[model samples]
Target: MKVVIVDDAPRVRDRVKALLHADAPYAEVVGEAGEAQAAIRLIRDMRPDVVILDLQLVGASGIKVLRAVKLAPHAPRVIMLTNLTDLEYQITCLEAGAEYFLDKSFGFERLADILRDLARKSGPDSEERAVL
Candidate 1:
């Protein structure tokens, strides 16, 4: 399962990558970006199966990247991870086509689990599950 990590904080990106590696070995970190434009470009070029996107990016909002990803052909499943835990923000992300919206404070493990489930569903033994 190819995955992309997009976060403005280098530490956060590294932590997420490490967590994914430690918990979801089947998930591969294919690409990463810290800003909206670069993240959008990477997503378009890499065509990863999943993208761990930060809701807050460097000098830009992650929603821009999300919108671009959603507009692309064969969009990947996006999980919005943000420090901002406002209900409205979560709803906004969901409405914008994010498969999952998680608060950064406690969503790391849950994100890993989601990735694992996605990997299992995409595996040869499982039935074909269409993922966008």
Candidate 2:
């Protein structure tokens, strides 16, 4: 599974990459970005199967990035990984077409499980689409 990680913090990106390497080895991080515009451009260019995005970016919010890319042709399944665990933020991200909205503090490990499921579902023998 091709993946892209977007977070302003370098440490968060590194940790996520390490987690994927350790848990979801099938998930390949094709690219990463530290801010909204760069993320948008990288996501557009790489067309990854999944995107791990932060809710708060350097200059623009992840919502903006989500809105911009979620409707495009063959849009990737987006997982909103953020520190903001408020119900409103979760609701907004889900409404904006995020496949999953997770709290960074509590839901970090869940990301790997989600990715593993996704990888299995999208494996060569599976007939269903990956993003579904």
Candidate 3:
């Protein structure tokens, strides 16, 4: 599975990358971005299978990035990770087409499992499409 991570913090990106490498080795992290416009461009150019996005960014908000990604051609699956724990933010992100919305503090393990499942389903030998 091809993946892209978008976060304002370099450490968050690094941690997520490390998790992916350790738990989902088959998932190739194609690109990463710290802000919205660059993230949009990277997602468009890379067409990764999934995007792990932070809800905040350096410039434009992550929700804007999510909206842009949803509009892109062959839109990739989105997994939103945010420090914000507001129910409204979660609802809004989901309404905007995020496949999953998770709190950054508690979501890494779930993210790893999701990535592993995505990688498995996307593998050449797999014939089933992941339902979520």
Candidate 4:
């Protein structure tokens, strides 16, 4: 599955990329962006199957990017990975069309499993399953 990662922290981006490389071999990191506008542009241009988005960006909120892209004709599945663990933030992101809202500290490792499942469900030969 094609993947785009949008996060302000280089370390976090690198770690996520490395994790995907090691655990989710079916996932390819097609692009990376550190800010909101760039992320929106990259996601539009790349049209990746999945996007790992951060809640707080360099100069803008990830919610803005999420809202913008989710309106596209073929919107990608978005997983919000952020340090913000507040219930309000999670609800907002989910309501805004995020497939998953996860805390960066505790939920980081769950990303690969989610990606793998998505890949399996989206496989060309497999029966299509609804992803909510």
Candidate 5:
């Protein structure tokens, strides 16, 4: 599965990408971006299978990216990787159409497994398994 990883912190981006790549060799990380606009352009152009996004992204908020991604044709499922654990942020993200909101503090390999399962599941099945 192809993925677009967007995070403001270089270390976080690299680590997530590396971990994902290591976990699933076929999971190619097509691109990476530090801010909203660039990520938008990349997503529009690449149309990756999924997006792993960080709320602390520079320039625009990750919520905007979620909104923008939802507007795209065949919008990729978004798994929000954020440090913000507040309910407000979580609620806003769900309302905005993010598939999952994950805390960066947890084990990311588990997050990748969820992504893989989501990718493998059918529409109805995927919708039923909403835990992130």
Candidate 6:
């Protein structure tokens, strides 16, 4: 699996990468971006399988990044990881086309499970299951 991590805090990025590595050591960290523009550039360049983004960014916010990513060609599916628990925030992110909304306070193991689920859903066979 390939992923681009976008978080304003370097520590958050490191932590996420470590958890992902623990889950799937083979998973590649294609890129890491701290701000919106860097995130945008990384997406365009790496075109990763999935993106783990923070809701609060240094600029433009993660919501904007979600919107931008969704608009990209063959855009990577996004999962929002943040401390924000507001219903409105969740609703807005879902509306913006986020594949998952996860709380960062939770264990990385939880996110790893979600990442697997998302990958399964992205596969071709998932369409058949969706009909059921």
TM-scores for every predicted model: 0.88, 0.89, 0.88, 0.90, 0.91, 0.88
Q: Which is the winner by TM-score between candidate 5 and candidate 6?
A: 5
Q: Per-residue lDDT of 1-67 in model 5, one digit per residue for the tens? A: 7899999999998998789877866678999999999999999899998888888777899999889
Residue pairs of candidate 3 with colliding backbone atoms: none
TM-score of 4: 0.90
| Residue-wise C-alpha lDDT for candidate 3, range 1-132, written one tens digit per residue | 789999999999999999888888788999999988999999999999899999889889999999998886577888888898688888788877787788887898888887666555553333332212
Q: What's the lDDT for all of these models?
A: 0.82, 0.84, 0.83, 0.86, 0.82, 0.79
lDDT measured at residue 9 in model 5 versus the true structure, 0 to 100? 91
Clash totals in order: 0, 0, 0, 0, 0, 0
Can you write out model 4's per-residue Cα lDDT over 1-132, one digit (the tens) per residue?
A: 899999999999999999999988989999999989999999999999989999889879999999999898888888899988687888788878888787787777898988887776653233232222
lDDT of 1 at 129: 27
After superposing candidate 5, which stretches have Cα over 4 Å from the reference?
123-132
Clashes of 6: 0
lDDT-wise, the better of 3 and 6 is: 3
Q: How big is the positional error of residue 101 in model 6, measured in Å on the Cα after superposition? A: 0.6
Best by lDDT: 4
